[model samples]
Target: MEISKNIRESKKNILLLANKKNKGHIPSAFSIINFVYLFYENKLNINNDFILSKGHGCLALYSVLEHFNYITTEVFFSFGDFDSILGGHPHLRKNNEIKASTGSLGHGLPIAVGKALAAKINQSSKKIFCLIGDGEANEGTTWESAILADNLKLNNLICIVDNNQSQNRSIPTPNLQKKFSSFGWDVITIDGHNSNEILSVFNLNTINPLCVIMNTKKGKGIADMESNFQEWHHKGITDNLLKLYIKEIHEEAIS
Candidate 1:
């Protein structure tokens, strides 16, 4: 549950920044930060490669990178502007910390597939982790890459679906684990915001490629946003609302 507290604090910060920037994608960002924290903290080998397919969730990545001292708050101040390193989507060239230039939905997995194959060819110990959105699974390219990952038997590859249960237009996420399992992936489901659960599932060494479906709330941890996916997904935080959010988050974090 402390992981949830950490997640709430990070989401609160990201939400405040997003609101100030007059930008969107806060809910999506908040939903995945716990997974990011899990990987960056213990699951992932950062010396290896990671591709976040849902690049709109860059805030999640940004927060982890900052927490790890990879980047500073000054860099995030220019977010949403054309000249900033922090953009609407993640650009790999701008930050060596990021393994892929991702923004187009459904591209991370394929790119990660290539990265995984390259590592295999080079006989490198590096593994490729791809974080994708559940809604983005609708893209045909995602499934195509899944087949390749299985056919290649890329045990070096790991895919995580952030099953936030909503995307643009606030649509419900269809059952993705069954879909991936039908494609021959060794699939497991877990609570997305629970770090311990995620770590346990990832530790399981399934010789085949693995897909961990993270069942998550769209706006996890934020009171006004958690269950109200429609309004909170991209809604800007007003000055008045931000104060209330901070106070509410403090109570939740301490309680």
Candidate 2:
């Protein structure tokens, strides 16, 4: 669980940076932390491509990259600053490790499909992994990409839905597994925070593209924030709240 420890540390840093910069997608970011963590720690293989389709969750991705030494603490702390390249959303130029620059909802899947198709045409064995938020799924482009992925039989394409059940207005999403299954995807539903279940989906072998619907809480790992997810969706952290987050992470790190 060293990766989990690293993630906790990264979250603490992200909060501190957010407090300094006065901007962050805290709830969205925390929700997908475990998904991103397990993807890099246990699922990512050589030449594999990963797309953060849920661009608002970039803080989690940024923190994970920093944890892996792809970015420095100085660069991470500069997030959202006027002169910094790192914004609320991820930019590929800011960090080459990011496969795609995404902030517009529903675009990541199509891009991932294209990448998967290119690998298919070249007969390359690279797999394309894209993480989409349940809210992002509201876009028609997502469904279109899903259909295209199934039509192309892009077995190398894997789409993970971070079904946190809280969208722009805190509205709940539909049954993602049923929706994806209807589109001919090999769908799997699991607790998003569980690393073992998340890792197991990577082992699935099928002719169609894979879709993992991860049922997750919007603000996981932090108690007060967890219940007040809508409020913290894109809220800035205060110094007092930052202290509490640091304390919570530290407690979890040891427990």
Best-performing candidate as measured by TM-score: 2
65-121 per-residue lDDT for model 2 (tens digits)? 777777787888888888877788888787677888899999899999999999999
- Lowest lDDT block of 10, candidate 1: 246-255
Q: For model 1, what is the error of residue 124's alpha carbon versus the real structure, in angstroms, after optimal superposition?
A: 2.0
> Which regions of candidate 1 fall more than 4 Å away from where they truly are?
1-6, 43-45, 167-173, 253-255
The TM-score of predicted model 1 comes to 0.91
Model 1, 64-109: lDDT tens per residue? 7776667887776577777888888899888887888888898889
Off by over 4 Å in 2: 43-45, 168-171, 253-255
lDDT of 2 at 183: 95
Clashes of each: 0, 0
Quantify how close model 1 is to the true structure by its C-alpha RMSD in Å: 2.3
Q: Would you list the clashing residue pairs of candidate 2?
A: none
Model 2, C-alpha of 135: deviation from truth (Å):
0.8
